[model samples]
Target: MRPSLSAFKIRANMKPILITGYVNPDLDGTAGMIGYAEFLSKTGKNTVAGVIGEPHEEAKYILDRFNIPYPLLLANANDYDEIVLVDASDLNGLEGKIDPNKIIEIIDHRQAHETDKFPNAKAQIEMVGAAATLIAEKFIKNNLEISKNAAILIYGAIISNTLNFKGSVTTDRDKAAAEWLNKTARLPENFWQELFSAKSDLTGEKLAERIEGDFAWFVLGDKNVGIAQIEIIGADKLISERGEEIIKILDKIKDEMQLDYIFQNTIELLDCKNYLVANDEKTKKLLEKILDIHFVGISAVRPNLIMRKQIIPLLKVELEKN
Candidate 1:
C-alpha cells in the first residue's frame, strides 16, 4: 500500500526539491535524476532537476519535450529540504551543496560501496544496467502516472547502458523494466536505432587514452581493476586499415597504464562475434578462448563491450582458476 500523501506533501512555501545527478551524469544518471524528480513532484513537492554534469543530447530533448525546468545551480549546498542523490557515488564531493544530515535518499544501479565508503547513505544499489529502470519501478510500485518524457529518458538510459541489451551485464530485470516503460513512452524504433548508431571514436586512438575514458571498475585480487570497452564495427576492414595502429597503441596502453590485461574489443553489430586485441598469447587465451568455437562470427562470450557484462564475471572465473 502507498503511504499517506498528507505528510509527504509540502506547502507552497517550502524549498524546491533538488534532483541532482552523479558527478558525471551520463545518459543513465541524467534520465534517473530527471525521471525521479518528475515522480517526486507528482507527489506534491516542488522539484528542481540538478546536474553535476550536463545532460547529453537525447536527454536534453526529453527535458525540453516534457517542459521540465532546469534546476538552479549549487553555488552553495544549504538549499533544499532533502537532497536526493541519483547515480551519486561520492557524498563528500557534493558537500557544500547538501548538508551531511539533510540527505534523505540515494539511488543507483552500480555496485554500492564494496569498500564501505559511504556510511551515511540510505541508497538503492540494485546492480541493474541503468538507474532509470529502478526509478520507473518505484513509480509503478507507488502507482504513479509515468510521464512521456520520463519514459524516453529512462529508455535511452537503458539502451545506452545496456548497448541495446547486448551488454553482458544486462539481465531479465533490466529487460522487463525497459520493456514495460517504453510501451507508454512510445518512441519510434528507428529513432533509437539511428540515435545509437552515432559511433564514438573507437578507431584512431592510443590504448592508454582509450582505456581511461571507456572503463568500468571491477575487483581483481586486492585491487579494483579497470576493464575498457573498445567497440569497432568491421573486423576485416578495421584490421586492414587500422590494425597496425591499434596494436601499436594498445601495446603502448599496456605499458603506460600498467594494466593487468587489456581487451581491445571489436563488435560487428551485424555479426555477433567479438574480436579482442590482447597484450599476449596468455591474455589472448583467457576468456571465451576456452570454448574455442570460431564460426562466421561466433564466440562463447562477448566480454569486451561492457566490463560489468564481461569483466566482472570474467574476474570471478579468473580468480577461481588461479
Candidate 2:
C-alpha cells in the first residue's frame, strides 16, 4: 500500500517539514525538491526545501535564471519531524547527514536503494527519466497551483534530464509534464539550446569540477564502479587535447578509490553524441559491445546513447553475467 501522509500531519505551529535533494544536487534533484516541497505546503504541511550539498552549475544557472529561491543548506535532518527525499534515496547520496530512518517520504525516479532503511516511509518511485516529471505530475493530479517559478524549474529539469526528450529513458509522462509546465512557464524557445550551451562551457580550469560534478559510485557484480559524466559542446576537442591526462586521472581514482572500473563519458550536447574514457581496456571493450558503439581513441563518438540512466542498467545486466 502506498503510505499516506494524512496521518502524519502537523498539529499547530511547528518547524516546517524538511525536504532535501541528494548531495551535489543536479537540476533534476533541485527541481524535484522545490516542486515537491511546494506541493506538500499546499496540502497543509508546511515544508521547506533543503539541499545536502551545493547545487551544480547547471542547477544554479537554472534556479538563478528563473529567480527561484535556493534551497537552504541542511547540515542534518535530526531536528525535523518529517523529511522528504527527492531525486535520490541512497544513504551514500545523503552523505550521512540525515538518518535514513527519519525519511518520511521519498519521491524519486531512479532505481531504489536503501529500500530497507525507509521501510515505513512512503515511496513514490517511477521509472521515468527524471524525478521532476513525477513531481510535476503531482501538481497536475492534485490540482495544486503551480507558481510560474515552480513550473519553470520543473520544466528546466525535465529538459535537462531528458535532453529535450531525446534521452532513451524519457517517457510519455515526462513529455506530458513538460507540456503542462511549459503552458504556464512560457519559457523562451531558445531556453533549452542556451542551457545546453551553458552546460558545455567547461574549460581546462574546471576539468576537476566537471569530472566530479556528476560522479556516482555503484556496486555492480561485486565490483565498485565509479562513473562520471562530462556534458560538453566540444567533446572531440576536449578529448584530443586532454585525453591522456583525463585517462591518467581516472587511473589514479580507480586505484586510490579501489574502484574496479572508473568510467567517464564526454557527451557533446550540440550533436547529441558521446565519447567515453575508462581506466582499462576491458571496461572500454565491454562498453563498446554493450553500447554497440566503437571508440575513437579514448572517446566513444556519437554512440547514439545519452543519459547515465540508460547506460547504468545496461552495465548492471552485463556485469552480472560476467
Candidate 3:
C-alpha cells in the first residue's frame, strides 16, 4: 500500500533549522552558532545561522579583520520550526525572544546553567573554556574541513574566552581545539594581543557601553545578582581614572534592576589579574568572603584571572548558604 498524502506534506513543509546564540551574544556564542551551522550543513543537514542581537565588538573585529561573513541578524526565531542554541542554555539569555519549546539542541559551557528549563532540547553542557571548542570538536571528529572563516572565528573565540589559555577554566580540550583550528585559521602570532586590544578601547562612552553590553544577571537562591566583566589591557588605569563612573553605572543598574548584589570583574590582560569593583558594603563583603581578597576603597585585586563563568558557581553556593 502507498503512503498517505500526510507523509508527502510533512516532507514538503519541513523548514531549515535555525541556529543561534544568546541575546547580545559574545564571541563564543557567535562563533559557535556560525561554526556549528556550517558543520551541520556540511554533514547533509539543513541549517541557517542567525543572531538575535548585535554581535559584540570583539566578534565584529575578527569578522571584519578577516573579512568573514556575518550571520543573519534575526529579530526572533518565529519563522523556524526547530531551533538550536550554541553557547546559550538559559532562558534569561533568550530575552523572551525564542520559545524554549522549539529548541531541539543546546551547546553551552557554563557550569551554572538553566538547561532544565529547555525541556525539549538535547543539551551538551560541558565545562570547557569556550563553547566554540565543542563546535570545533564536531568538525574534527567527523573529518570535515572547516572553512577559513569558521576556523578564525572559533580559534579567536577559544582564545578570547580562555584569556589566551591563561584563564583558570582553560582545559586540554580547549588547547587541542585551538591548535587544530589554527592550521586553517593561519592567524598571526600576535592575534591574541590584537584581539584583546580591540576590546580594550573603552574611550568616552565606550566604557559604559562595554560594561552594560557584557553585563549578566542571575537569580541565585533568593538574591538577584549582577555581574559585569571586562577583559582589557589597562584595568588599573581605567579603574583609577573612571572608578567613580564605574560605580555610578553599577549603582544606576542596581537600582533599576533591583538587584541584591552587583560587581564588576575587570580582567587585566597584561597583568593576568582581576580588579573587582563593587560600591556597596554588602557586595564588598560577599566578594571578600568568596574571593579571599579585601576591598581597598571600591575595588579588590585578584592575582589570577577568573572569568564570570567560574565565579557564578561560587556565588550560587555562597548565596544559597545564607
Candidate 4:
C-alpha cells in the first residue's frame, strides 16, 4: 500500500473537479471528502462529493453537528470533468461510482501503490494519520470556517484513522492539526472518552477476525508477514489501561493464523511514543537494540481492536524491506 503515482498521469491542462468515493459519512471519511471538495469549489472547480457506498450512520451525527450541507447524490458521475478521490485507500474498490476516463486526482491519506495512469490528476497521499486532517488543512488554507461540527468530524477522523495516533503512521503534523481543529471548533474531551469505550469485542472472536479486520499481509520472500496498528490518543485514559492486553490478543491471533511474521505498533495517538510487538525474536531484538524501539513478541490471541487505514501502508513498507 505504499504511495504510487502511476494512476495519476497529470495532464498539462485540467478540467472541473468532482470529488468521489469513501463517502462513508464518518468523522474522517465524509468530512475529509467534503472539506476537500469545498476547497475545489472555492477555487472555482465544479466540485461535488460522491459516495459510492452507503454513508455510515455516524456521518449524520457529524454533518448535523457541523451544519455542512451533504453533497447531493450524483445522478451520474460523467458530468464532471475531473474526479478527486479521498479517504479510499483502495481505488479499485470504487467500482461503478465513476467514469474510468474521468479520474483526474486522488488526494488520500492512504498508501495504495497502484497509481492508475490518468492524464489529468494528482495523488496526494501522506501515509500518516487521518485524511481529514489534510482536508481540514486544505479548508483552512482557503480560509473556510472551522464550524463546530466540522471540527468534531475532523477530530473523530483523527481518532479513528490513526487509531488515536497509536499506529506508526501518525506524525507531529497530525497532532498539531488535530489540536488546531479542536481549538478552532472547541472540541471536548468527553466526546473521545465515550467513543473509545466501545471496545471491539476482544473477548473471544477468532484470531482470523483480529488479523483480517486490523491487519494486511504481504509476501516477503518465502515468509508472509503482517502489520497491525493501534492508535491511542493522549486524551483517552482507556488506551493506557487496555493497550497491552490488546497487544497480547493480537499476538495470539498471529500464531493461530499461522503467520510467519507479525508486527504491531502501539502509539500514543496525540504524539509518537510507539509501543511494538514482533513475532521473530531476531526482528524484535533488532528493532530495539538497533532501532531503539521496544515491543512484546508472543503468540495466540483473540480478535479485537484495530487501526486498519494506517497499518496497511506500514505493512507495505516493511514488505519492501523484507
Candidate 5:
C-alpha cells in the first residue's frame, strides 16, 4: 500500500508518535493499534495510529459498518519522530519502514524475540490470546473512556483472534475483555456469526487478495519460508471447491518471491481445525517432517491446528532442526 504523503506532514514541536501494528494487519492488529493510540491520546500523548498495509477485507467491512476511520497508511515507519508498536514486537513483523531504534514502546500479546535490540524501549509483551485484550484491560484499569467506535473495533478483534474463545490459544483475559466491551458496545448476538460468514465469503480476486495480503515470511537456517493463513468457516468446502485455484496463486507467489518454501493453511474457525497445503514436494516433505501429519492429495488435515500463532513457531523449530 502506498503511504499518503499528506498524512506525514510534520509541524514544529509536534513530534508525532506513530502507533503501528504488524505488517498486513489483521483485525486484532488494526484494532489494537487504534485502541492503544486512543489510550495514549487520552494521556496527552501525540500519537496517531499508522497502518503498514490496507486492512483485511473483514476488517474493512467492520470499520466501514461502524464508521471507524482507518489508520494513517504508512509506507515506512521511519517517517515519524517516534514509534510505538501494538500487537507486534519483532522487527520482522513490521513493514521495514523504520530503524529499530525509533521504537520507544511495544504492547503485544505474542512470544517475544530479539527484544534485546530495543534496549531502551518499554516492552510489555504478554502471551494473551489477543493484543486487544491487553489494550482493553488498559482502558478499564486506567479508567479511560472508550469511544463507541473503539469499543466495537476492540471487541471484534477479541472475538476474531480468539475465534469467539473457542480457539486453543484463547485465554481468560481475552474472554474477560470481550465481556466488558460487550457491555459497552452492546453488539448483537448475531454479530460474531455474521463476521465469520463475511470472512468466509472470499472468492476469486478477493480470495487471492486474502492469501497474498496475509502472507508472512520467516528466515530459518538461511532459508526463507512463507506462510499464509486463512481464517474461515467450512474450510473443507472451500478447499474442495477452490483448492487448485488457491494453490496455483500460491505457487506463482512462491516462484515470483523466490521463497525456499511456501505453504497455505485454511483455518476452519467454526470447527477449530486447520487444512494445510504445500506448494511442492520439497516443502511437503519438510511439512510432513515438521508436523508429522499425513497428507491427502496436496492437502493435509490438521483438525487440531487452529492458530498460525501456534503453527508458525512450531514450523520454525522444525525448520531449524535441519
Candidate 6:
C-alpha cells in the first residue's frame, strides 16, 4: 500500500529546492527530474521539478500519452536558492543557463561528465543505463510511495535510455528498476515499441529538427566534439535516402558551433545496429580509431548498437592522449 500525499508535508522554514536537467533534455533527464522531485517531496522536502529548455520529442510523447503534467518550464535557475540536477552533470549541456555554484546536489549516470564543475554540489555520478534507474531505486529502497505519473515517466525513460535493455550501457539495476516501476505504471509489454515509434518520425523537416534537438557537444582535451544521436526504426532507409541531408546538417552545425569535430550516430531500433555518418576526414579518422569501423563514403555500419553515452568515454580516452 502507498502512503497518502498529505502524510508528508513540507517542513517549515525550508526553502524550495528546484530539480532540473540539461537544456533540451531527453526522456532520461526529463524523467529523472520529475521522479527525484517527487522522491524529495515525499520525504518531507520542498522540491519543485523544472525544465530549462524544450524537452525532446520522446519525453513529450510519454507526458502527452500518459496525461502526465509537464514540469515547470524555467528559463534559468535564477529564482531557486538551491538546485538539484538529475541526469545532467555537464556544463556544456546546461548551455550557460544554470549557475554551477548554486547547485546543491547532482544525480547522473554518465561515463564522461563534468561533475567537477559544480564546486559546491555533492554528486552521485554512476554509470547506470539511465539516471531514471537511480531515481526509481530511491523510491523502492526507501519504501516510499510514488505517483503513477512519475513511475510512468521514469519507466519510459529507462526503456528509452537503455534502448529497451539492448544498449551496451544497460545494467542489472536498470532492469530491476524497470520491473519495479512497471508494477506501478502498469504499462503494456509492447509499450517500448510504442515509445520508440513515437520518436521515430523523422520525416521532412523533422529530420533536421530531431538531429539538432538531440545533438550534444563536449570539450575533450583541446578540441570540441559534437555528436548527434538519432534513434529511428528505419535507419538504413533514412541514411540511404537522406545521407547528403544529414551531412549538410552536420556541416552547418559544426561551422555554427565552431566545433573541432562532429558526426551523427543513427541507431536502428528494429535492426539493433548503428549507422554512423561523418563528413570530414578528421571526424572519420577519430571514429575509425575509436569504433574500429572503416567508412565507405560518408557513412559506416557498426554491427552492434553503441550509444553516445558509451562512445563519449572512448573518445575522451583517445582524444586526451593526443
Cα lDDT tens digits, model 2, 173-270, are 99999999999899987788988988877677578777876888788778788888987778889888888888887777787889887888777777
The alpha-carbon lDDT assigned to residue 217 of candidate 3 equals 96
Evaluate model 5: give its TM-score.
0.91
- C-alpha RMSD between model 3 and the true structure: 2.0
Could you tell me which 10 consecutive residues in candidate 3 have the lowest summed lDDT? 7-16
After TM-score superposition, the amount by which residue 259's alpha carbon in candidate 2 deviates from its true location, in angstroms, is 0.4
1-322 per-residue lDDT for model 3 (tens digits): 8988998888856778999989989999999999999999998889999999899999999899989899999888889888999999999889999999999999999888888898899999999999999999999999999999999999999999999999988999999999999999999878999899889999999999999999999999899999999999999999999999999999999999999999999999997999999999999999999999999999999999988988899999999997
Worst 10 residues of 6 by lDDT: 4-13
Q: Estimate each model's TM-score.
A: 0.67, 0.91, 0.97, 0.58, 0.91, 0.95
RMSD in Å for all candidates: 7.3, 4.9, 2.0, 9.4, 5.3, 5.4
Candidates 3 and 6 compared: the better one by lDDT is 3
Give every collision pair in model 5.
none
State how far residue 123 of model 1 sits from its true place (Å).
2.6
User: Per-residue lDDT for 1-322 in model 5, tens only?
Assistant: 7656665554443876998877768888899899999999999988899887677777788899888888898777767868887887777877566678878888887663556776667988888888989999999999888988889999999888888888877898888888888888889977889889988878668889889888877777678888889988888988888889989988898899899989887898777788888768888888787677777888988767556667667777877787
Ranking by lDDT: 3, 6, 5, 2, 1, 4
What would the TM-score be for candidate 2 when compared with the true structure? Answer: 0.91
For residue 69, what is the lDDT in candidate 5?
Answer: 86
Candidate 3 backbone collisions, by pair: none
Model 2: residues with Cα > 4 Å off, grouped in runs: 1-13
Look at candidate 6 and tell me the lDDT of residue 258. Answer: 100
C-alpha-based local distance difference test score of model 4: 0.58
Candidate 3 vs 5: which has more TM-score: 3
Off by over 4 Å in 4: 1-16, 23-26, 57-61, 64-69, 73-79, 198-306, 309-322
Scored by lDDT, the top model is 3
